[model samples]
Structure formats: structure tokens, C-alpha cells
Target: MIRKLAFLIILVGLGFAGVGGWQLWHGSVKQHETMKKAQALTVTKKDPVKYKDWDPIKGETIGILYIPRLDKKLGIVEGTSPDQLEKGVGHYKSSALPGKNDQVVLSGHRDTVFRHFGEIQKGDDISVDLPYGTYTYVVDHMKIVDKDDRTIIHSTKPKEELVLTTCYPFSYIGDAPKRYIIYAYPKKK
Candidate 1:
């Protein structure tokens, strides 16, 4: 009776594990499709967005991002706050949108998605090619800050800076004490 009972338990456990795996895979596929569709240009139907009209309201979820220096291409999530982490890239609804003169702040997972950032070099070219036109940026500086610094999100004096933030010490086990910030300046024509 003991042997039979043990086998039954193992079989039930395996069934649960299979169900969990399926759920994860299914959720990931759905999120990917949503992000892909979000990245698709919806504003093209409207008038062109002027660099002058750039404002925080323009912040929107991005589909794909390319960094030449890191040799990384991945999807971008907006709304980096704790809540938005579950869905794809969540845009910082309050921060200035990309291509604007102000800070275009973006964040993502360092381990799984944008991990190549660890290999980024200064003077590297980072570009975001949206459905509209290509927005180019040149990496200027990279700094690691303490995680509590809410001040970093404020608009810069010049408003032409872009800051990308992620956890520091890439492999940190728990919450990261510091944040790795990459500053990039928009490249003009």
C-alpha cells in the first residue's frame, strides 16, 4: 500500500509541474504578441510628431530596441514601476518620451532581456527605430546609483539626455543596492 501511494503522489506532482510549465509558456507567447502589436506604429495615421512637440505624454510602450555597442536587440517595456513589471516593457508614463530633448528614461531586466548592457562601451551608438523614423543616440556616460534615488527620474536641465536604468552587480541575489544608469545624448542630423 505504501509503495502504491508514493507512486500516485509522484504522478500527481508531475502533472502539476506540466501544467505550470504550460501556463508559463502560454503567458509568454501572449505577452509577446501584445508587445509586438503595441510597437506597431499607430500614430502614422496622424500628423508627424515634431521633435519640438516631444513631451511626457508621448511616452508609450516600445516593441523593439537595438544597441550597437552591446550588440543586443530586444523588446522594451514601459512603466518600470513595480506593478508594470509583469506585463511586457512598460513605458514611463511620466517621463519624457524618446527622441525628446528631456530625459527619455527606460528600464528593463538585466539578466534575461537586455543583459548585453553589461558589455556596453562608451561612445557606442544606440538607436531606437520606431515605426516612424529612426531616433539615434550616442552613449555618453554610464553610472551606477543607489536604488533609492528617485531624483534621477527628473528632467535634466538641457532636456536632451536619455537615461537607461537597471539593477547593478548583474548577478545580485536580492534587491540591488545600486542602479546602473546609462546616459545617452541624442545624435543630431
Candidate 2:
């Protein structure tokens, strides 16, 4: 009877591990596909492309986010839905686009696309490459706020800014109660 109980426990543990592994693998595959689509939208012309007057639908690939300090590039999707975030970083739909002279907010899972988010420091460079143009921002500051904070998303109208958010306590195993926020401003030309 004891042997049977041990076997059942071990089996359950393995089952959990298998499910976790599958989730990670699936998210990675989706992100890879999203990156490919975003890359295809890259504009290589000598002249810069103008920003379009249209908004992306949920789950749409909008652009690519480049973190120079981490040597990482991630796809930027349209919304923050679970399906969209599973693909890559999710861009808040109501936020302004690159070069829009307003605020742009982006969020990603701490364990996935933003695993190295804590490594980013002030003065680091983050750039977004969209079909229209490439805009670069320099990290200015960072803060830790409650997960329920609503002020994190606000208007920076007339001035362009970028905000990157991820769950705090990067090592936490479950939903973190705090948020790590990084504030960046346009890089001087």
C-alpha cells in the first residue's frame, strides 16, 4: 500500500512538470511565429515610413522591441490578452504608438519574453521597430508599485515616453503582488 501511494505522488509530480514544460514550449513557439511576422513588416527603405492612422486589432503583431543592453528582441503584439501575451510582449491598445508624442505602454510575462527584465538599468537603450519607423528610448528610471496600481498607465501627451512593466520579484513562482515599472524617454538624436 505504501509503495502504491509513493508511486501515485511521483506520478502527480511528473504530470505537473510535464504541463509546465508544455506551456513554456508552446509560448516559445508562438513567440517565434510572432517575431517572424513582425520582422516581415520591417521597412528597409532609405526614407522613413510615415505612421499610419489605424489601430491594430487584438492579437495582431505590431512591431519588434529591441533591448540593446540584453541583446534581446521581442515581438510586440496589439493587446494584453492572455492569447496575445502568450505570443510575445503585449502593447496596451489605448497607448500611443511610436513617435506619437504620447505614452506607450508594454507588458510581458516575467518568466517568458522578459526573463532578463531585471537586468535592464538606467541609461539602457530600448527601441521599437515598426512598419512605419524606428524609435529609440533611453531608460531613465524604475519603480516598484503595487500590482493594483492604476496610475501606471497614464497620458504623457505632448511628450513621448515608454513604459515597460513586468511582475516584480522576478524569482517569484506565482502571480506577483507587485509590479516592476521601467520608465524611458526618447533618445536624443
Candidate 3:
């Protein structure tokens, strides 16, 4: 019985490993292809009035985000739904878009798309490719907060900021209780 149990455990472990490996490989490939496409995209200048009238559908590809520090690229979807997150990062619909006012909030699954987020530094550059134009942001700070923290989402003052959120302890398995927040501001000339 003990030998059979051991064999079963090994099988389960192997299954998990296979799935994890496939996810990593597939996500990386998709990101690379997406990044190439993003670089070639061109859009009109962003106008605040046009954004206000825009309607977004869940799971729709909204933009592309590139983090030069991590050499990572990911597609930004419209909503933070489970299905959307599986493909890439999700943009908070309530927040402003890339070239608009207020904070543009983006969220991603830590184990997958945001695995290298922990390595980001204050001076790192992050670029967003939107339907309007490409905007660049420089990381300013990072913080860990409770999962339920509302301060991360709500802005206090009028500012053009980009906020990236993911599960804390980037490598943690299962549902993480804490949130990791990266605050970035528009790059200055």
C-alpha cells in the first residue's frame, strides 16, 4: 500500500509540473508575438473626450504593456475577469486609460505574466501601447498592502499615474493574501 501511495503522489507531482511548465512556455511565446505586433501598431492621439465615450467588453484586448527591466510584454485586456487574466493582464475598467487623467490601474497573475515584477526597480521604464498612442511611465515606488486595500485603487490628488497590482510574494502558490503595488508616473523629457 505504501509503495502504491508513493507512486500516486509522484504522478500527481509530475502532472502539476507539466502544467506549470506548459503555462510558462506558452505565456512567453504569446507575449513575444504580442510585443512584436504592439511595436508596429499606430494609433491616433488620445483625446479625453473620445475615451469617455468608449465602451469596453470583457476579455477584449485593450492594449499592450512592456516592461523593459524585465524584458516582458503582456496584452492588457478590458476587464479583470478570470478568463481575461489567463491570457494576460487586465485593466480596471473604472480607471482611466493610458493617456487620460487619474490612475490607470492594471492587474496580472503573479505566477504567470507578472513573475518578474519583484525585480522591478524605482527607475525602471514601463511602456503602454494604447489605441491612441504609446505612453511611457517610470516606476517610482513599490508597496505591499492587504488584499482588500482600497487606497491603491482610489487616487487622492489629480495625477497621471500607472498602477500595477499583483499577488505579493510573487512566487507564492495558492491564493495569496497580500497585494504588491507598483506606482509609476509619466516619463519626463
Candidate 4:
């Protein structure tokens, strides 16, 4: 009986290992392909409107985001989604655009969407290439605000800046109460 039980346990362990290995292999392959496609994207320069003026990203598409500290370079999307964020970028309607008014707020997933975001540090370089031009920003600060903190997401400052948001505590299994927010200012156009 002991031999049979031990043998069963070993088999189960091996099965688990196989499953884990397969998942890791699959994830790496998918990210590699995504990186290839993202790298081939056509990037645009940042178009800066006058301080009080406004202009949305042409084509309503942000090609990609390059962060030196992150493990992956994500592709930006027009809409928010696990799929879109997983690739590297997402859109938030309420936030302003490159040269638009208010904060250029955007949303992304913590682990899958903007996974490398967890590695972002103050002063890190964040380069966003829009249809009009490339907008560069530097990480200034980060905080975990509650979901009700609409004021953070509802900024209307007439300047070039970026506010990136995602659920907090990267590995949190349940609905997150606080949000992980990164504040960056436009460093270059």
C-alpha cells in the first residue's frame, strides 16, 4: 500500500511539473512573437500642441511604449483589455492625448497587461510614440489609490504628462481595492 501511494504521488508531481513547464514554454513563445511584431511597428513623433491648445493622437493609435527597466516592450491599443494590455498598451477615453488637455491617463493590467510596469522606478525613461510624434516622459512618482479616487483619473491639466494605472499588489488574487498609479511628466517631444 505504501509503495502504491508513493508511486501515485510521484506521478502526480511529475504531471504538475509537466503542466508548469508547458505553460512556461508557451508563454515565452507567445511573448517572443509579440515582441517581434511590436518591434516592427511604425513609430510616430510626438506632436506637442501649444500649452493651452489641444490635439489628439492621429489615427487614435499609440504604436508602442519603450521602458528600459521593464522585461517586455508592450504595444499600445485603442481600447482597454487583458489581451491589449498583455501586449503592452491600452487606451482610456477619459484621459487626454499626447498634446491634449489634462493628464494623458491610460489603463493597463498589472501582471499581464503592463507586467514590466512593476519594475518601473522614479526617473525611469518612458518613451511613447504616437502618430503625430514621439512623447518622452520620466517617472516621477507612484502611489496606490483607492478605486474611488476618480480625481486622479479625472485630471484636466493642460500639459504633456502620462498617468498609468493598474490594480495594485501585482499578485493579489482578489479584486484590488487600491490602484497602482505612476505619474510621469513629458520630458521631450
Candidate 5:
């Protein structure tokens, strides 16, 4: 009877590991595909007048976020839903896009696309490449706030700001209680 119980426990453990592995593999595939699509959408020159009226649906890759310090470039999707984030970093649908002279908000899972988010710091250069143009931003500051903080999404009107958010306690295994917010402003020419 003890042998049977041990076997059952091992089986269950293997089952969980298999599921976790599969999820990680699936997420990697989705991220790769999303990045490919985003790269295709990027243009060589800035053409604000070309895609000015472009609108993307949820899960659609809208741009590429470049973190110079991290040497990372992640695709940016249209919405912050789980499905969208599974593919790439999510851009809050209601937030303004680059060159809009307003706040642009982005979010990503702590374990995946933003795994090294904690390594980012003030003064780092971040850039977003869209079909219309490539906008560079310099990290201005960072803060930790409750997960429910609504002020994190407010408009910066007349100023083009980029805000990146990820779950805090980067080492935490589950949903984090707080959020790590990175505030950046457009890099002047």
C-alpha cells in the first residue's frame, strides 16, 4: 500500500511539471511570433502622417519596446488582457501612443517578458518603435505602489511619457501585492 501511494505521488508531481513545462514552451512560442510580427510592422523612417489613423485590435502587435540597458526588445500588443500579454508586453488600450503628447502605459508579466525588469534603472534609455516612428525615452524614476493604484495611469497631457508596469517582488512565485512602476519621459533630440 505504501509503494502504491509513493507511485501516485510521483505521478502527480510529474503531471504538474509537465503542465508547467508546456506552459512555458507555449508562451515562448507566442512571444517569438509576436516579436516577428512587430518587427515586420516597424518602418525604416519616421512617417507620422502615414499610420496616424491606424488602430489595432487586442493581441495585435503594435510596436517594439527596446530596453537598451537590458539589451532586450519586446513586442507591444494592443491590450492588457491575459491573452494579449501571453504574446508580448501589453499596451493599455486607452492610453495614448507615441507622439501623442500624453501618457503611454505598458504592462507585462513579471516572469516572462519582463523577467529582468528589476534590473532597469533611472537614466536607462528605452525606445518604442512603431510603424509611424521610433520614440526614445529616458527613465526618469521608479516607484512601488499597491496593485490597485489608479493614479499610475493618469494622463501626462502635453508631455509624452512612457510608463512600464510589472508585478513587484520579482522573486515572488504568485500574484504580487504591489506593482513596480517605471516612469520615463521622451528623450529630447
Candidate 6:
């Protein structure tokens, strides 16, 4: 009976390892493909005349978020719905887009696409490549707030800003109640 139990334990452990390995493999492949697609697409800034009128379809890729420190580049989709997020970072439709001179908020799943987010440090540079231009923001600070925090949406006037958010407690297994917010500003020439 002892030997049988040990064998069963070993098999269960192997099964768990196999599942983890597959997840890692699949994630890597998906990321590689996203990067490739983003690289192939040429982005130009939105025309000023139509900037305010611009609207995107829910799952459409709107921009690319590139973090120099993390060496991560992810496509930014138009909406924050589950389907959009599953592909990459999702841009909050209600917020301004890149170069709007207000809050441009983005969100991603910490466990997958934004897993390296915790490695970002103040002064790191983040670039948002839009269809018409590429805008870069220098990291200012990071803060943790309740998931329902409303202050994050308040506008910071006269400055082009970027806010990237992910669930807090990066490694937590269950639904996280806090948010990890990274604030950055336009990189000065």
C-alpha cells in the first residue's frame, strides 16, 4: 500500500508539472506572435482633424506598449473586455488615447502578458506606438490602490500621461482586490 501511494503521488506531481510546462510554452508562443504582428504593422499618429472622432472596434489593436526595462512589447487593444484582454493589453475606451494630453489608461493580466510589470522601476521609459506617432513616457511612480479607486481617472492637465494598471499582489492565486498602478509622463526631448 505504501509503494502504491508513493507512485500515485509521483504521477500527480508529474501531471502538474506537465500542465505548467504547457502553459509556459503556449504563452511564449502567443507573445512571440503578437510581437511579430506589431512589428510588421506600421503605425502613424491619428489625423488631428479626426482625432476626437476616432473610435475603434472592440477587439482591434490600437497601439503597442513597449517597456524598455522589461524588454516587453505588447499590443494594446481597443476595449477592456475579457476577449480583448486575452489577446494583449486592453485600452480603456473612455480614456484618452496616446497624445490626448490626459489620462490614457491601459490594463493587462498580471499573470500573463504583464507578468514582468513588477520589474519596472522609476525612470524607466515606456512607449506607446499609435497609428500616427510613437509617444514615450518616463516612469514617475507606482502606487497600489483599492480596485474601486476613482482617483486614477482624474485628469492631470498640461501633461501627456500614461497609466498602466494590473491586479496587485502579482502572484496571488485568487481574485485580487487591489490594483497596481504605474504612472508615467511624456518623455521630454
Backbone clash count, each prediction separately? 10, 0, 0, 8, 0, 6
What does the lDDT read for residue 3 in candidate 1? 100
Query: Model 4 residue 166 lDDT?
Result: 91
lDDT of 1 by residue, 1-189 (tens): 999999999999999999978865764674566456555643243334543453323334554567876676555555665535444444566676665557777776565445666788778888765544566788888888888988888877566777777888898876878899888888867
Off by over 4 Å in 3: 18-52
For model 1, what is the alpha-carbon lDDT of residue 22? 83
Query: Which regions of candidate 4 deviate over 4 angstroms?
Result: 1-61, 81-87
TM-score of each: 0.71, 0.96, 0.83, 0.67, 0.96, 0.80
Off by over 4 Å in 6: 1-33, 43-52
Native-structure RMSD, model 2: 1.4
For candidate 3, write residues 111-140 as lDDT tens digits: 888987899999999999877678899999
Q: Per-residue lDDT of 15-66 in model 2, one digit per residue for the tens? A: 9999999999999999999999999887562344444575889999989999
lDDT of 5 by residue, 1-189 (tens): 999999999999999999999999999999999999889889565568877766788878999999988899999999999999999999998889888899999999999999989999899999999988889999999999999998899888998899999999999978899999999999988
Query: Predicted candidate 4: what Cα RMSD to the true structure?
Result: 5.1
- Regions of candidate 2 where Cα sits further than 4 Å from its true position: 43-50
Question: Which one is best on lDDT?
Answer: 2
How much is the lDDT of residue 189 in candidate 6? Answer: 95
Error of 4 at 95 (Å): 1.5
Q: Candidate 6 versus the native: TM-score?
A: 0.80
Q: What's the CA error at residue 58 for candidate 2, in Å? A: 0.6
lDDT (Cα, tens digit) per residue for candidate 6, span 1-189: 999999999999999999989976776675566556666553444565665666877877776898888888898778888767767888888888877788899999999889978999999999988766788999999999998997898676666789999999998887899999999999999
Least well predicted 10-residue stretch by lDDT in candidate 6: 39-48
Candidate numbers sorted by lDDT from highest down? 2, 5, 6, 3, 4, 1
C-alpha RMSD values across all candidates: 4.5, 1.4, 2.8, 5.1, 1.2, 2.8
Two-way TM-score contest, 3 vs 6, winner: 3
